[model samples]
Target: MSEVTVTVRGEHETRVAPERATIRLSVRAEGSERSPVVEHAMRLTEPVRDSITARKESGVIVDWTSTRLSVRAERPWNNEGKRLAPIYYASIDLTATFIDASDLSIWVSDVSPWDGVEVGSVSWHLTPETNARLEREVASEAVGVAVARARAYATALGLHDVEPVEIADAGLIAPTASAPPAGMAKFRGMVQESGDMTGASMAYEPDAIVITATVEARFVAR
Candidate 1:
């Protein structure tokens, strides 16, 4: 007698609003000398950091880092077609991660006034607990779908017993956040109304994070 085997695949997807957010801010400064450019970039970090700390909402975390720093002179042609004195350029980046979305508006309003500092992306995501819970639920649903398909296959083959021989997690899909607003002008205006952060009610809303789970199951019939 020969044994019969069936392989089935199941997929499940779930969407949920994000519960956490990461906001990045950048500072760029340029000058004729390396010292001045670097100094200016470093000086710009104070106000932005101070502003976030001043927020009424608690649990707001701020992290500052230097993404890029370069001090090189670039020669340019003058009206006479002669190379002019070299110009030096320097740039720095700072990022802030906030647990509460409520502080986004105020942070933007306060930091927009700075000359070189600009608001970066605002990524939203579900917390670890919520993500884990969703993963488990979706995994179960996917396996159920696979089991049903396997049983149907066994019945069609005139098999009495159908047992799952192999099962595997196909790796869950990660969630993606919506792109940040186009510019700070509109975002600043949205929060300037009452000088209050637009907690979860900003004019722009992040897209719901989608999570997908898949499972592959192999069944054998006796």
Candidate 2:
């Protein structure tokens, strides 16, 4: 009878600075009627557009847009009671990109609206250059970790050599954030705050994103 043998697993990690970032901006407005609400909401586009343009000129902003627009009616608590006031709302969103770290920081500070506007959230991303560099570093780290573990296993088994039979390189895992999932509330808020051209504050915070990768290797006992 022939005996079977197996090798243990190994792992390692490497950290690198991120290069690229993606910013998501959302604007909302509301009113009693769709037309009025849309009108007010549309006005927000100007300021938002200006903000993006300014950032772009400074070389901090990459892209901006009023991608979403929604309109809805305000419902009263009591169905039987006469509607006290009809409400309409609309929302606008913008996205800005920056390459330099200092520029990115400045952009975040500048983009924050003190009034009449809401900052949904902000996120950081790894640029292609950073991503590629990290991939190589991580792969090397992983291989080093694997070899270390393999050496330990071989020593325990009193083996002189171990051969790598197969290596599975599972590329990097891009980072992502979870959206509100529903746009109804977002739209409603925009419409409700339509009249307040000054701006409104929203309860949202930027999230940190982490990119990762993994690999699997098959080794043979020699």
Give the lDDT of residue 90 in candidate 1. Answer: 65
Instruction: List, residue by residue over 110-191, the lDDT tens digit for candidate 2.
Output: 5455323565444555655665666566566666676677767766777757777665543212222422211011111111
lDDT of 2 at 180: 20
lDDT per residue (tens digit) for residues 1-222 in model 1: 358878877666667766766666666777777788888876776676566665424556543344655455688899999998777766666566665566665566556667777666676666668866877777787788888989888788887688988877543222124322111111111112222332323433556676666677788877
List runs of model 1 lying over 4 Å from the truth: 1-3, 55-57, 62-72, 79-81, 157-160, 169-202
What value does the lDDT take at residue 54 in candidate 2? Answer: 79
TM-score winner: 1
- TM-score, candidate number 2: 0.68
How do the predictions measure up, each by TM-score? 0.71, 0.68
Q: After TM-score superposition, what is the CA distance of residue 140 in candidate 2 from its true location, in Å?
A: 3.4
